[model samples]
Target: MTTVLFVHGTGVRNPGYEETFKLIEKAVHLERPDVKVERCLWGDKLGTKLNAQGASIPLYDSTLALDEEEEDYSIVLWQQLYNNPLYELQVLSLKPGDETAGNPFGEKPGDELNSRVERLNPSTELQAKLDVAGIAEVFEPARDTVIQSEAYHQALQNASEELGEYRDAIARAIVAQAMLDCEQQEKHPPILTDAELRDEVVKLLSLALGEAELGIGDWVVKPLSQLAQPIGTFYLKRRRGIITQSVSPTPCDILLYQGRGDRIRDFIRAKIEQAEPPVVLLAHSLGGIACVDLLVQQALPPVELLITAGSQAPFFYEINALYSLEYGEPLPDYFPSWLNIYDLRDFLSYIGANVFPNKVQDVLVDSKQPFPRSHGAYWTNKAVWKAIIPRLP
Candidate 1:
């Protein structure tokens, strides 16, 4: 059976896969039942795994860890004050002649017993105590040789780089802890009063932790398999005729593949090996770049047809000099039957419009008409399929 692999774009969450996959799958089944479809899933777990393996991932630092630490300190301080009831009474019960008594408008008789005695003197012994706790020694240098040696500077640089990795570890830990807390709390029966608010707070904390964990880094450079699995469920659904597919590879990632087209070509080659019939690559945005790169590297099977919508092929050629990258191996004098469908408004696809330097047949589908959404609504456009159906061998 013919195998169609659907790759999705970026910024997608798990829920998005569910909805989009269903649409693509339904469309595929209606059009070709014998064809096997697969959706690729790439999310938090995949992103994390890639980062752990030394891939550079983008992460967000919200200072949540620091804020949590500060809040915990404040809570402990407040609890200590409440526990010592005598501390409050000692300040309020001062009277004339008492050792701890204070003059109505002057320094107290016993500075040690007076809670507010520090407020009475601008430069007092109590102030020195606070300063010694490091609050006033912020500029002090470390006594260790490691802090002053040339090796120290090198270590500092290393530390700076490791901070990024450290924060990522902390974020992941927080997410895991939050998940465990949520599960534990759910086991207890509901308490009707203030517990409702507490429950809501717990839920919000869990979500925040998850966001921090997932935001640890960008996972694009990771292995395609890592990125593929999370998206697999969607592709699997598409294979089963449940959802529509969309692919948007990052610009940087596409650039990498353009230089070494073998990455994607190898992936497709593996899939072709798995199934007997040829594979159809439905690509969008930068995904088209990857497809072009693949075409240049190897003699791909007689691809039934190559379909690209809102693609960025022309930009690669136009700015090839600036990017310092090769346009793929030259296309054959007679290229594969190709359909390049694009809307005028989608500035992304327009980059390749009106130009087919490679001699590939370019069929522009005028989606300027008012029905389907312009940039993203490629697959939904009936005109798209009209152009595609005849070309499919």
Candidate 2:
């Protein structure tokens, strides 16, 4: 019978390892019942622990807060602008207008302007300007979306008196709002990804209305930048515990391994020797490094296949950091078949095929997660299992 010996990666301790191991164990048993599954469980004995009970971690203080406070605040402010491009216009319209005598003409400026504004078609007017600017694809759906919005109609009615004086601002707001709506829905024809381009688009739309230069959304940028430091400091102070707990493990494990790794390799070899014949070593992260080093230094005949998920062994080999291998040396003839699994989002995972040539097979899987989560996502990913099951001895 084929025996799959599971070896865990860095930073995993008893209860946490038990939870993750159960996931691996259940998956194997459900798919290949005939195959025997066992765990090497080396982390408890050989893994790095905070011997000083985390006395090394520095404490957070007001002076130690993030340095990019203004930049971060600008990002947040821009995100708000993107989500609600009409906010500035809304504010402008609500502010008290200059008191003046009634017009002696047939119609008031507000009434005359509102009539013209209601008749203006975004597709035709905005499209003509956008065409000259070569961004014509953004008009149709954007126009359609704005005209259908109840909020758009309400804003027009609520701000009718101010509309005559702030016609340009109102026009730019409508166009900007339409573009933002389409962009959020992923239907914008052109990628208005840059804030500069978005500002230019608003300018073009205002120009299309035959309006002079009007500072539509410029009032809040400076104020928001000023507010960033205090807000960021308070947030950081509250989230210090959460941030440290989530990010400190992996790097600590790596540093520990670089400083002391012999105990980990010995623990792995002993487990391999005790396991049943035709053993497959399924190792992850730093555990993969130890397995590769062990196989390269001394042959383990019982181990038929070696699978490394999100491993850095190839990177270590290239850097001349792998204990048993050097930069230009080839894998020994006694080494078993190697399957390297990686996820595109997992930045730590490195391809081994380039380093080992035909001896290693590299497979890509999507964990549908971002960076750090992707590193630990392999065990739950179906693509990982499909790749491994067929390669079992």
Per TM-score, the best of the predicted structures is 2
Task: Evaluate all candidate structures by whole-model CA lDDT and list the values in order.
Answer: 0.40, 0.66
Q: Candidate 1: how many backbone clashes?
A: 26
Using lDDT, give the best candidate's number.
2
Worst 10 residues of 1 by lDDT: 62-71
Count clashing pairs, candidate 2.
0
* Candidate 2: tens digits of C-alpha lDDT, residues 1-393: 888888877655633466567667877887888888888887676666668766766666422243334244334443334446554445454544334523444444445445555565555655565654334665555545554555444444444333432565555455566556654554423323324344456665555544645453344445556545553353334444455554456666777777777778888888888888899999988889889999998988998999999999999999898888888999999999999999765778999999999999999997654345457768767788899888887
* Per-residue lDDT of candidate 1, residues 356-381 (tens digit): 56455565665432111234556545
| Candidate 2 off by > 4 Å | 12-15, 60-244
